[model samples]
Target: MALLDYWVLAAYMLGIVLIGVFYAKRNRSAQDMFAAGGQAPWWVSGLSGFMTMFSAGTFVVWGGIAYKYGMVAVSINLCYGIAALAAGYFVAGRWKTMGVDTPAEYIELRFGKSVVQLYTWAMLVYRIVGTGVALYALSIILVALMPLPEGNPFRDPNTGNLAVEWAILAFGLVVIIYTMAGGLWAVLMTDVLQFIVLNLSVLFVLVFMLQAIGGVGTFIEQAPAQFFAPVSEGYSLYFLMGWVCIHFFMVGADWAFAQRFISVPSAKEARKSAYLFGILYLVSPLVWLMPPMLYRVIDPSADPEQAYIAACLSVLPAGLVGLLIAAMFSATASLASSQLNVFAGVFTENFYRPLMERRGGSGNLVTVGRWITLLIGLLLIAVAISIPYLGGAEKVIVSVTSLMVGPLFAPTVWGIFSRRLSARAVWSCVLLTFAIGGAFKWLLSLPADGSISPSTLAWLTKHSAVIELGIGILVPLSVLALFTFVIDRNGTPGWIPDRSKNATSNAGAMASDLPARVVAVAMGLCALLLMLIALISHERQLEIGLFALVTSGISAAIYLLGTRTKIAPEFQRAL
Candidate 1:
């Protein structure tokens, strides 16, 4: 990377911080800080939900699969679409209808305070570890692209970049600042900005790649036949289906996602937001994952985990390379910020507020929330350094996440629609299924060493993902079914409290065009930035110029539309 590229990265980081400062004043209370005061547009909320599902993992993990396994990578991502669509129809709207500020409140209402305690700590620990892994994964990418001087003490002897520990801390502090300053609104707005950067990067790189390789047809004809296959050896059809099931629980019940569902104004809007998320997932993955697959044709021997970055570095110009890298970091930071905001909200609302006997909220709620954000941010940095990727441990951690998500949240989702289900069912399914899964995995699954061949061992490793998913999901659901239908036939309706807003309250608030205007300005500025880069670059002028031109045209149209959008008199006054 050149000095211009580093300048672009520096400018991008500064812009993100400015955005956080811009939104900071709007947050006056913990509710406004954490929940957007129930004012976020459906599209913004939906887009935010989509981005939260991404991280450095998308580049490192999924992109690695795309490079090695082919269409299965896109196939795996498509499950998020199916899972999200299902959630929109059955689950997302229900979460909105429950009308709680946080998912913990809903758990407490449906089960009890004890379940709330259990779920909060469980989710907090889960997300903290996951976020740390994500941070560590991001440093892996950055170090490959931007290594430090060989003699610098901070530089890693292996890869020569600032050691992963320092890189993780730097990223963590950036997340903490923006999240603490602007809260969810900052998180939401940055998500929108990152979406723009990511897709623009995708569009530009795809065009350049297609040009260099002759065209789409040439690349496809040249690619390995396996690249087009729906399923591969290890990522089989069963694994694909299991991926869908796991994310259904994730999209519908995980607090980071559920927060989006509950942040919207009404049940109907919640459905729309989730539907938008689903539709984007369905359409976007093909475009998003194709670059790595194309890179396989260019350099099949490239490290799988570094394939996406390697592809971008090959096609994108100097400043644009920095922009693309910035976008990737933005993806990881946005996800971490979402989790940070969520646990902070949970701590502030469920733990701290209640302990102070001020469950109604307090004067220092926002202040307290920011402090919690900082604490968790530090914890994430610590955990990132402790967790090492020895013997491809990152992949192991990814698989663990998939296995654990299914069992952890399946019962919570089941309770959403089933009033007859009780707290006992949640506890039973989680603990019992975990025990059985551990026994089968460690005890029964292992056979005498002479009984297993190398080929069989590899096959088992590949196929075990699906089996673990099956046990995690089926065991919990079966337990819930047994308890509800056979064991506890006399159970009463679970108390699903009504914290929902009245229809009259919603009728008084008209839709605002602020989100549209926000998008317009964001796109317009991005185009201008691209054009500036185009002027400075001496090579590939046509390729870069076309991208800038099309982007600017779209920005202009969005701005015009936003300007003409008429607000009701009362709503205008309110905004």
Candidate 2:
């Protein structure tokens, strides 16, 4: 990266930290810090959830797959959309309808405190490692961009970039700082910022890439026959179907996503938020994933993992490349911060608050929450630095999310509807399912090394993703079904709420407009920065200026649209 790019990247990071600091003052209590105090509009919560689902995995892992395996990468991502849409329809409104402040609260309510404790610790460990894998992915991109001299102490000879350890340390610290400072409100606003930046930046990448490749139709005509196939060995049609089910359990019951569902005012708003998230995912993947696929044509020998960013660095002018990298940071930061906030909330509400002999004020508990956030952040950093030794980011991500989601979350999701599922049965079924899945996915699979003869079970090894997923989804639910039907079935359904009341928000008119106006001004500033750089350099001035003009136009449109939603002055005064 050029000196200008470094400056741009630094400014973006600093801006993110400042956003956390800005939101910090508004967080007077743990509820405000962790729950948005239920003031977030549906769109804000929805956009935040959408951005939280992104990280460097979207680029490095899926983009690499796109470069190598054709359309399968997009297919894998589309699974998230399909799953989220299902979540919107089946479970998003139910979260609000249950009237729970936190998913853990619901867990404790239905299954008792022991189950909540078990679920909390288990998921905290699970999600922290997942976040670590994401940070590891981002570190790969960063280390690639910042190359080092051969003899430099931090230099990595293999890639001639900074060492992964140092990259992980530096990036992890930045995420931790912002998460500790900003809390969940900061997470929501920054996510919205990332949503805009990522979309606008990728559109620019698509434009440039298409221009370079002549056209989509021309590229398609000249491409290999298999370039557009939607299935591959590891990502077959069965895997995709199973993938949808895994994410359904994930989005519907996972604390981070469920937090988004309950952060809104009403059940209707919660469903609306999830629908918007699903809709965005449905449309955005093809556009965003195209750069890497097109890059496969541009340079077939290019390293697949770096293909997405490489396409941008190769095609985009300097300032915009920096902007795109910053946008990538926004993606990783959004996910990391959201996870941190959710985990902190779980610790505070489920464990720390309950155990206190004399409960401090909510503000004091908020301080305790910050401390817990720091502790988890430290562990996440430790895990990220160790990711290379643990068989790389891709393996860890696929193995964990696929092999564990069903066994861990399915029972929890089912408990929302079934009263016959006792705590003992839940534990028995989840642990038993894990043992079965571990055997299928890990213990019984061919060893990672050139191990016990390749011909022993090549087909089983080839299709392990689908197998693990099938067991993960089917095992726990099947056991639970048996327990409910064949074993015991004589209780009222657990405290199910029949209807959700419309909530009167404590936030007045100005507060209602906060998210939109903040996002608009952020967009305008980013646009101004791009135009200024293009003006100073006088290279690709037209493209950059036009991009800026369109971006600023969107900014104005959002701000004006926000004005329409503000309550009339008298109404605000009445409140």
Q: Which candidate has the highest TM-score of all? A: 1
Taking all chains together, each candidate's TM-score versus the true structure is 0.93, 0.93
Give Cα distance to truth, residue 414, candidate 2, Å.
Answer: 1.1
TM-score of 1: 0.93
- Candidate 2, residues 381-409, lDDT tens digits: the string is 89888776776556557767876888778
Cα lDDT tens digits, model 1, 73-177, are: 899899999999998998988887776788887888888887887788777777887777777888877777777887998888987776877778877888899
Query: Where does candidate 2 have its weakest 10-residue lDDT segment?
Result: 502-511
List clashing residue pairs in candidate 1. Answer: none
State the RMSD for candidate 2.
3.1
Which window of 10 residues has the lowest lDDT sum in candidate 1? 566-575
Q: List the residue pairs that clash in candidate 2.
A: none
- List, in order, the clash count of every candidate structure: 0, 0
